[model samples]
Target: MIQQGISPRPEAQIFDADTHLGSNTFSIGPSRTSDGSTFLAVNSHQPWEGAVTWYEAHFHSEQGLDMTGGLFPGSPMILVGHNRNLRWSFTVNHPDLVDTYVLEINPDNPNQYLFNGEWLDLEVRQAPIKVKLLGNLSWTVKQEVLWSVYGPVVRQDHGTYAIRYAGMGLVDIWEQVYRLNKATNFKEWQSAMRQGGFASFNVGYADREGNIYYLYNADLPIRTEGYDWSLYLPGDTSETLWTQYLPFDDLPQVLNPAAGFTQNSNSSPFQTTLDPDNPHPDDYSPTLGIETQMSNRALRALELLGSDESITFEEFILYKYDMTYWADSDVPRMVQMILDAPTPQDADLLDGIEILRDWDYDADPESIGATIAILTLYDLARTSKSFLGSRLVGGEFTSEEVLDSYQRTVESMLEHFGRVDVPWGDINRLIRGNVDLGLGGGPDLLHAVGG
Candidate 1:
């Protein structure tokens, strides 16, 4: 709502803005400037239901961006333009912004819950869910909404538990978003960060002032005494209500470190930049749950960015498209495990094994090796039912076992697709427009979706 600068950059400028500010009940990029300099008015909102239509109307009417069917759930985007000397971009801020606590309900009166020692009355509300069964026929299911001193209470057979997530009952996030869009300098932007209502997602920032910053933004709850925030804690006592948050300075972040660049595709912060400090794991609270897993996309981004000093747009795009998995990566291990099975191998299985063993691990439409490896791993992961999901254990495979997995993939292909020669596109697609176009990524590749 305010403007502070009026200059423009004469060079071939870049303006990138990313957003992760949609509401959980509903749904939610990079940039460059072409007009010497451009300022954009950015705003994102929560969609409690099927609100994608609203997003389409807003962008087409206001920003003239072709964003219909682009605002998928779990994916946030940003818009760019001119506001004066400020050209800003946004990316999601990732931090542990939610917490759950198990409540001890009073046996005599379910309305009263026992916390640390005292009893507290539950806040009650009503929410309706709509479902359609047949043509033009629909029904509504009304559910009781219970709240403890913390936040919303989710009831199950185990017990009633309350979840406390940042901005759970707030609607002022757009205030910060609008301010960031018009901020021209570090001071203005830092002031906006202090306002801090953003819940989670890693933030990527760039400005016309030649300043770039990264913030792992979140409004983390500061718990009361004797309560472990990690697990479900007693939820009935006033003592359990955690209303404070650590200062923004206390949050893990990188601001113009010795490393010139930083990136995150939902990966471990330990490897974001080449800086020595690298946000040590010991510094964050155990309750934060900052993910340490090194995803295929994160690994590839690091490889591409860390390998070069200067980068061009063409190189950035190419890096995004790179599909090959490093040799020591999880995808290759899946292939290697199947190939090294100890069981006796038949000629049919051996042929499939040979195809995978020599694969480049690239998930292009033409790459059969990539197809087999990805499909087999997907099946394995889908079937594993443990609490932690389908993570591979240590030293779990040899060459012969991996070859056997290759044979299984061949059999699966023949059984499901009616042939082993079906194109990868025939199975994987990116549905948009009136066409269901074939997609170009796989489970372990840099650009990927469902494994």
Candidate 2:
């Protein structure tokens, strides 16, 4: 078994950081376009500067590989982009691929754990890590790493835990990207996907031949029923150990839906397209842990693209740049919650609430309401774990928390700008080398921003 390198830390320290990895992708087939031409918008939202930031490049080879797209540093092939025959983009998808097991350690031996009816010894190794100290000084530190039958092991004060995740030892991801880069047709592209190299991503594809596809691709483990996979499993039993993955064909996918378009904004897979064509949530196993929440971006996409029968290229581009949050989205709902709360006596808080009440739900640069809403929500997301996770998963928030966040927003605005009626663009800016531009969109909108 391959040993996964995991740093030992307290269980409480492990938090959900995947909410920031958001992307938006959509494909329109010939039936949905005015000129009978296919359209694809490959938009991925990522940090402006980081290790995971995107770098655009073009790759060509005499071996029939010619593609242009974005990739991270050190990536051998383009992760999402278009070849000559077809274009595809990737949006991050959340599936229950990782599981934690609470191990029953042997009473007498710290290096042994109970498995089935036997006490099995753990695989231990020393991992050397280099640390940089001053300018030219460094230190080498050796850390003890342990591996159990389930996977990497971490010993805590309470008990020992093992982590098992998809693509634990798989190394063919680059090869799969290479194959996707060279595929000339839908059949070839589907064959490449069938290789099952990608662990998680919602793929959006549009071809020159008028074919469009959306796939909720994941290497979901064939977990047994009758157990809550979301909770920690009993490590002492082999029955909780899953060793097989669901087949590629078993995954949720849509090919050339009659609705004429497909979209994913890190939302639920069951609502990828129109009602009759979308994948049913009941068709999949509950152990898959598929997301059932609809993001604001996804809701806007459905509202814009679904209502249009023949979309022109210009209209498609305009829709992609949509800055309005849907009426039923969480943003409007949260705004209402604030309005319905008990009226605050403070003048600044009252003004802030009025600004939000009278303002339209558009994230335009000139919108003053968006300035307050986005800043307040973004601050809440940074400080509260529940708020951050709930933004994507559709979790509930208490009135106290919402009112407190608004109060903080008023204080912050007064401290920084001396007013709460500042324009959205003035507060939300995109600064680069010699170019500081005003931005129009807030988080989770069609034209999304991290702020």
Candidate 3:
């Protein structure tokens, strides 16, 4: 490791990768919308999974439904869109649901465990796992799947653990979606949400009745007050067991926010609207584990949307496609770190630094320095502050790393494209069939380029 550091071996570094779903959704009521009707907009990006398609459903003796979104074949959308008086969409809310408990097994029988001062037998079952060796030739092998009062148990070489996750035995999740589709008003919608099988998602809603809402909806277990839920709990007692869920009314929500708009970019629910209307983080329990980071998309959305009181439909769409990463956002901060650093004496490094400094924050096609700036983040994915894990959710990188990444980006661009001053449009493109268009947005922007 020491010898390799003598030369520029960026490849010697190992990246710690983490990824989570990111999406943007917002709603506007009649007072703020263009057509005198509520406006709901969603840009759910799942590039690997593809986008949602419009669909219509008509059932015998039931209300017809029109939807402009698709779902995974087996999954249901309690986040119904344009089905009734209201339209709704979802952004993933990564609430705490899963918990692990360290098991203390009985010495005489591994199948027995101690719970609340008494030893009890674990409920063990063997399920058949079918494996295929060749085409149409399969074998069934029985694997032990154990269960306990805690929920489920896993035995590994290091230790025994029991896990408890919310909605473990859920079967009527589809029913909730179906009910949500048929709900014509706010009351009906709330009743449907009371069923509460949704594992993760923050719902954004707007209705023809001039109502708008944002909900940080989840089926989260009500954990006990004392223990550190981040670590494994002691399984010997029932103290770690969390049975109840926060009531539907307790989930973070805002209805008809004073700001005239509500939005979530998979960020904190506390900042869903203007400062006056945004939820107070201290009001909710830390045990719920609500997200508190502001995304670049969220910051941009607030700057654009909240700036105007009488925003036109054209402006609404314009705000949705806003591509500039906010000044305080990770991208700009990281880039500034590189720019403010002492310019290296090398010719190419000086050229790279100048490109970054001359660049405007926008990712438009004609932006001269945009190519090198964006590619720097792209080339050094995990190592780049604004490109790591969830950039919008606040990532970090050192000044040294940022400068190194910029150097690599300049080197790569010269070797391949043969120039550092190439347009961002030339490098980052949206290609379909034989046609190509310049992608005007960077990652996590409201107008996502790839997704």
Best by TM-score: 2
Model 2, CA-based lDDT: 0.86
Q: Candidate 3 has which clashing residue pairs, if any?
A: none
TM-score result, candidate 1: 0.71
Reference-based lDDT, each prediction: 0.56, 0.86, 0.75
Candidate 3 Cα outliers beyond 4 Å, as residue runs: 1-21, 48-63, 74-80, 384-387
Per candidate, the number of residue pairs that clash is 40, 0, 0
Order of candidates by lDDT, top first?
Answer: 2, 3, 1
Looking at model 2, the pairs that clash are none
What ranges in model 2 sit over 4 Å off?
1-18, 128-141, 342-350, 382-385, 389-393
Q: Which candidate leads the pack in lDDT?
A: 2
Ten consecutive residues with minimal summed lDDT in candidate 1?
A: 20-29
